[model samples]
Target: MSDVIRASAAPKPVGTYPHARRVGDLLFLSGIGPRDPATNAIPGNEYFADGRVRSYDITTQTQAVFANVRAVLEASGACWEDLVDVTVYLTDMARDFKAYNAVWAEYFPDIDTAPCRTTLGITALPTPIAIELKCTAVVRADNRQD
Candidate 1:
């Protein structure tokens, strides 16, 4: 059986989709951003209502994005260790890759436990956020420690 997972602690998806979908032992997550669930605010984003880009910090946004992804994983009865793969979308590759990689290493300290990852530089995202992460996780019965 398959199930859709919505995490109350994470920001609602920008489109009409659930945070994640589960089939068998795997959970596929939608692209997650750095928006705060309670305030709908994007951390480290400086795009104003006037459509001008100000200052965007990749490190700050990366931290928030990871937190949002964690909330979804937890809601789906999984954890960081269960993550098997991830695809990262970055608006500015030349400017942001170093900062993003630094934050990512903090989460996946060991190279052996780190998920396989692909990062793509895009022209833009649905929102003004600098980065978005889409991940797949292995959800074992014992991973539901919650």
Candidate 2:
């Protein structure tokens, strides 16, 4: 059975899925949006407060998505250092690529240990969120539950 782990710092999933899942040495994270837990807001997706959905800007949304990813990794007793792979899906790939890479570089400052990654342009996402990030990481040795 897989052990489900939820990151306290990340916004709660709006659907039926854990923030992450630990199976043996690996953790698989679900696609995450730029939702803020404190505000219960998704800036560029469906707006909760105004009841008006807004389109996402590349930079802000990308950073927030990565932040959510980091929160999940930390909550799962792992970190970017443990990440082995990442998959990014975007609605506007050509225009958003630069902004996405900039924030991505900030997150993985050590380019030498970069995880394998796949970035693709999709026609649409669940919401208007510009970007979604999902990852795979190794459970750190000291924090291994099993």
Candidate 3:
């Protein structure tokens, strides 16, 4: 049976959806951004008077997003190493890819063990955050009896 999962430590989803879902041995996470759960504020981002993003630090957002992804994984009885694939969305690829890649390497250090990833440059997102991550991971049966 499949299960839906929500993580209290992660930011609340903007729409009507759980933080993640599990089916068999695989867990799928909704697109996760760098917004703090307690404050709903996007880290490293500054907004203009009109609410548009004035500037952002890709390194900060990347770190925060990774932490958010980790929260959902733990809530689903999985862990960082279980992540098998990741899809990253960036609003500005040309200017931010290097910083983002640096942060990614900090987390995934070894290429052989790192989850396969595909990054895309998108025009915009629902929020003003510059980056978002969609991830899928394996759930080891040993950590859960569900």
Candidate 4:
């Protein structure tokens, strides 16, 4: 059976979607952004008068996005080590890649055990955040038919 999952600890999804869905042994996460869960504020971000983003700290966004993904995994009875794949989106690759990658290194630490990852540059996200993550993990061991 498949189960839809929502994480109260993660930022609420901007649109109509659950945080993740469990299909048998796999947990598929939605695009997780860096919005603060309680305040809904974008960290390390400055806005223009019209609410457009003026400046953002990619390092902060990257760190928060990873935390958001972790929250979803934990909510779905999974763990960080259970991650098998990740897709990263960045608004500006050339400017942000180094900082983002550095924070990623801190989180993963070991290349051999890290999840397989692919990163892409995109024009924009729905919000003013600079980074977002979509992930898939092996939740088979905790497969208790949620």
Candidate 5:
């Protein structure tokens, strides 16, 4: 009910959740999946393009998820540098953990200052997608009387 920030460039949310929400000086973003916004379809190889929902492999999926996160952060008046925490939910962590890390490294090159995070394996998510990420960021005020 307060100020809400939406990432117009990010893939649209499938349901009633904002890409991110801004409250006070913090922004809490909803989990993002891997479907490409341009097509609203998951990326697939040559054999699976008949509109039959196909789950993208870990690499492709993680990339899309990150893109979504980036879009949300930008729209919320924040950036990756402002990230304070993150949560990753996986339907099958054991199978895709390494792949997820591979993609994560590209974005978060410096782990020393990476935001506080937690990863968990869950039974299911909104879609058949493989990975999802949610994050929180702080928005520093510019004209503070300090």
Candidate 6:
């Protein structure tokens, strides 16, 4: 059986989907961005008056995106170490990969234990935000009932 997971501490999903879904021992997270749940704000996003993205700070946005992911993991009774894989989406890889990688290192310091990752350069995202994260984590032993 599978269960949908929602984290009130994270921004409500922009579309009709739960923050994550768990099946067996794995939790599959939806793509999460940098928007704040309480304020509906993107920390590092800068936009033009015409609603086009002018620029964004990759470091700050990466932090917020990870924070949101952390909230979802915690709500699901998991943690960073439980993460097994991740898919990263970036609107501008040439402009942002260095900053994003630096911030990512802070969370997963050791390469051996870090979750496997794949990053893609995309034209745009659902929001004006620059980056998004989708991940899979193993449910903690305590949270599992067989």
Best by TM-score: 3
Q: Taking the tens digit of each residue's C-alpha lDDT, what string does model 1 give over 1-146?
A: 88999999999999999999999899999999999999998888676689677888899999999999999999999998999999999999999999899999999999999999999999999988999999999999887542
Best by lDDT: 3
Better model by lDDT: candidate 2 vs candidate 6: 6
* lDDT of candidate 5 over 1-146, digit per residue (tens): 54677777888998998888787788889888877878776643223477444445878888888887878887777877788998999888999899898878888889886888899999888876778888888877751112
Q: Against the true structure, candidate 5 has what lDDT?
A: 0.78
Error of 2 at 2 (Å): 1.8
Deviating ranges (above 4 Å) for candidate 6: none
RMSD of 3: 0.9
Score each candidate by Cα lDDT.
0.93, 0.84, 0.94, 0.92, 0.78, 0.92
For all predicted structures, in order, the TM-scores are 0.94, 0.86, 0.97, 0.94, 0.85, 0.94
Per-structure clash totals for the candidates? 0, 0, 0, 0, 0, 0
RMSD of each: 1.7, 2.6, 0.9, 1.4, 3.3, 1.6
lDDT of 4 by residue, 5-116 (tens): 9999999999999999999888999999999999999999998999877899999888888888999998999999999999999999999999999999999999999999
Q: How does candidate 1 score on lDDT?
A: 0.93
Model 5 clashing residue pairs (backbone): none
Where model 2 places Cα greater than 4 Å from the true spot, the runs are 44-55
For candidate 4, the 10 contiguous residues with the lowest summed lDDT are 137-146
2 or 5, which is superior by TM-score?
A: 2
Model 1 per-residue lDDT at 136: 100
Instruction: Put the candidates in lDDT order, highest first.
Output: 3, 1, 6, 4, 2, 5
Task: Flag the better candidate by lDDT, 3 or 4.
Answer: 3
- Deviation in angstroms for 109 in model 1? 1.3
